[model samples]
Target: MEIVKGSGFIPGDLLSKINSPSDLKKLNEDQLEQISSELRQYIIDLVSVKGGHFGASLGVVELTVALHYIFNTPYDQLVWDVGHQAYGHKILTGRRDNFHTNRVYKGLSGFPKRSESEYDTFGVGHSSTSISAALGMAVASKYKNLKDKQHIAVIGDGAMTAGLAFEGLNHAGVENANLLVVLNDNCMSIDPNVGALKEYLTDITTSHTYNKAKDKVWELLGKISKFGPNAQEIASKIENAVKTSLLKQSNLFESLKFRYFGPVDGHDVVRLTKVLADLKDIPGPKILHILTKKGKGYKFSEEGNETVWHSPGLFNKDTGEIIKVIPKTPQPPKYQDVFGHTIVELAEKNLNIVGITPAMPSGCSLNIMMKAMPDRAFDVGIAEQHAVTFSGGLASQGLVPFCNIYSSFMQRAYDQVIHDVALQNLKVIFCLDRGGLAGADGPTHHGAYDIAYFRCIPKMIVSAPMNEEELRNLMYTAQLDEVKTAFSIRYPRGQGVMVDWKTPFKKIEIGKGRKIKDGKELAILSLGHPGNLVTEAIERLKEQGINAAHYDMRFAKPIDEALLHEVFTSYTKIITVEDGCIIGGMGSAVLEFMADKNYSARVVRLGIPDNFIEHGEQVELYEECGFSPKKIAETAIEILKENKQTILKQGGTSLHDKQA
Candidate 1:
């Protein structure tokens, strides 16, 4: 293993001294700076080797070091918003040895998990949760009358765009809680931030006059305090009034009742520590805006596009060139690629077609579409609520809007989906990419709840595609004016089953399923990509002399009741498989349909266990959850044998009589 050296360290000098956060306290401020450089290089090398989140951790290296050094962490609660930037914090807090295993299955989680370390105050993956969670902890500490401790929330500028962040700010401001919100401003949020608030923050950060005046006011206030209490009060009021007036137009943080500070250079460790140490003495909700570059160290990462370096694959550490993997055959298109390409193709012919993604053009594969039809495709930054309502606005103006949001991210726009789209009955197609276990991204990125949530909303057509062709067809069908309802189509993250991409698009009959094979003893009904497992299970059953029928019930909400009823009457045993949880999922939908008609067929639900799945490879996770083809086959055989034994005991009736 070729070791990359960083500034202020020989090889293993700094790493050897630190075992945990407590070990970090022994190091002085000057030494801590040296360690920060070493840590940054270590992170760079590790990410280069193992392909994990890069830019976020790089941006927070100094801040992470400063926080642990200044604050009595574990006891003095420090919560990281989104937790992508906690890689440094993790290394410092006794996980340095295991850092290489980050994002791997059953290994170190990419984000701060409560189970992983006590220093990690809260688990985070979804953005904008830090302030609220920290404030809650602060309030809980107060309720317990613990006055010695401190509570701080370190959030990125991008995460601050979330509505929940504002909600936390508003509530914390009124509560007068001793909460410190460190806004780690890199001027990006997955993509550059959108909305008026982001622009306002940018303007404030750039305003030299505002910062200089505020500094002079502080100096004047300090001198006046020596005269008398009355003089100090007058000076304080005057300074605040001046600061408020100058910042009034542009300061969103101050308006939310926070004592706004900084636009501080986040990279300056000494300055950051000094500022943080000063803020430790002060009380109430405060905002410390620290500006840093996203990919701070190493020449290529520093100069390279932040987004490309954000979560890059395995790369050559020396050149920062990503190690490209040649495909055995033509590699199947990523689900996002399919969505992006299909939308562009649709937009080329239809003048009304508009594409909108909530700050995930690159992730959702809409970047190409955005480039091709810049006017039509919109990247609405991290504001999912705004994206949905904006799409609604476009729909009202006689445009066919495709609001492509990650299935997990759409949770942020649930209210907008219910009120703006479904309530108004707008023709908007929600292209939900990563609709199930998103592998390494973990539970925070899982698209598990969309089926349950979207199904309940009235006037919404919720569907999932079994393969690439079906996805394209569904996208086409969703665009039609006749489908004057809010439509959603979810698909998994990676490539669909290797099918011929040249097949012409066709509109699949909505709320229908196709019987793929015929059998007598057992049946496997499934939806989405998990349906592929049924084919393997059926072939395995044939070898065992157990004839198993298979049906691909593509639509989850408007289920194919006719096909389901026929299968229920025909088969002695029925199994429903899906990639999602059984509770209120595809299997539950099938069971609900069966119960509505007072039909009872011996049914076995084969799907993800009703528990949050941890980060892992998609294949490993599928097998663990019993969604893999091998597990499906074994499960089917076990259930069939059990049913056969019960039938023999009861003296089995003929197939015709059982149907009657």
Candidate 2:
């Protein structure tokens, strides 16, 4: 094994040749410990400077080394859930040199991407999908008669609590496939996990029976491979023998027909390697639950707050101090923080108000309410479907539920949103954070489709806030008893335009848009945070003496018809912009309005194109999608240049004359 040189720390004496899993297999078993230590340090060095997910990757270093060492990867498939712990996996799988570029623009993806490498069997960003994806590969291998191929799903305990994981387990139990689900029980999912499953898994881990019988169960499992043809029979005997103690209480996986094993120490690389090697010999469908800490090996990470350290951007590795850009002036707060603080303020006055999120208490900033009024806020664990229906139930009982979910993740619970909320016309105000291009996390995490998806739903109020003030106002209006049907308030990931954002909460009339400025040449219509970008473009256009009107169209659904009439009857050239998809978005809604009113104009729609965007900074992605201030200005200039040509060809009829 030869060292693939990366930019940062690579221990010169050790881990010199671990280029890939095949290269890793060349080294002696005893050397695995040295490799694990080096691997952990390598991640710490790179992530401290370059910035990506920490703790989660640090926790799984030993398990990562053990899995790649045992399994013949790129041939024997391995799927990761969420890919938070995939940095070590990426480094070990010939990406050591590229580690520094992990979530940067046009570099390697933060998550497992099938296009980038052959080793990443399934592209993953969201949680609880490893089981489903890995099971499909296992079933396909069975069909092709690939007898030697082993399929493994490395899923965390937090991901295990989701409905899809159990659904996969149920189906895998019935199918005669060579599948192994390695449950990395680290008691976390961005934030610490909650719900009944957390306690159930905790019960299995703490029980004396599991600890006492674990060795005997492994001893019997070790002997099964030696039985050759009778391995299945011996495996059944071993499983039946442990049913009295371990299986009786730990029937969650066992009842699903998966042979349950371990609550083993995941840090012990040697033991993990031996156990994983043993499981390979006797497996139809089985699960190995291994215990681990969220941030292992690093002293600072081990002691620090787990949620904050999950993705602590640009930190001092030596000092263990997180780097922050201390502005000279008091700047604007993040849109999510505004939502968090504003919700608590609203809940204080309204007894019927409640808050809920799908395990993103910290990420979405709902932890504010959870801290202030614990009874009012709830974190439902990694179940997007359940979160929507649960909110609907609350709304049905005359209680208002501000169900917050990331824009991209809401795609998973579309059926529930339609059936449980909108169909019943329940008053569930969905606070969609990361409602546009979510930087670094890439396509799977990007909240680009929410505007398009929610626009068509009947009895649904689709809205986006241009600033923190509008965000608070939208929240205030949605929860009011006068407003009917479910409401959605989509906002961006970063800080808003206003520094002094905590204004008195005001009720915005539903579907009414405010005109920022009026012009004679053409008008620019914008939705959500991108309306701020349109404001910048207007400044640039003013320099060229190209007067462009700007409108902050607050609502996409029941789109301000009064404003549309003013826009269409006055202007022949129009531009619509959003931080979402172009197809069936706010832009499309504007075009539909024009057609219905028999108003003709050269309408240009700018947003996320009909393709999945890659990982990059938000500015880089916005430019690539042609919706950045610069790009938006360029579009406006190009439209005017073309209109100038049309002016000359049509007997020199000016834009002002046409509008008049």
List TM-score per model, in order: 0.93, 0.98
Best by TM-score: 2
Clashing pairs in model 2, backbone N/Cα/C closer than 3 A: 1-17, 2-17, 3-16
Which tens-of-lDDT digit does each residue in 275-382 have in candidate 2?
898889875998999999988998898998988889999999999999998999999999999999999999999989999999999988999999999998999999
TM-score of 2: 0.98
lDDT of each: 0.83, 0.91
The sequence of per-residue lDDT tens digits that candidate 1 reaches over residues 7-104 is 22222578656777788888877887798898898888788877799888999999998898889989999999878888999988987777878899
lDDT of 2: 0.91
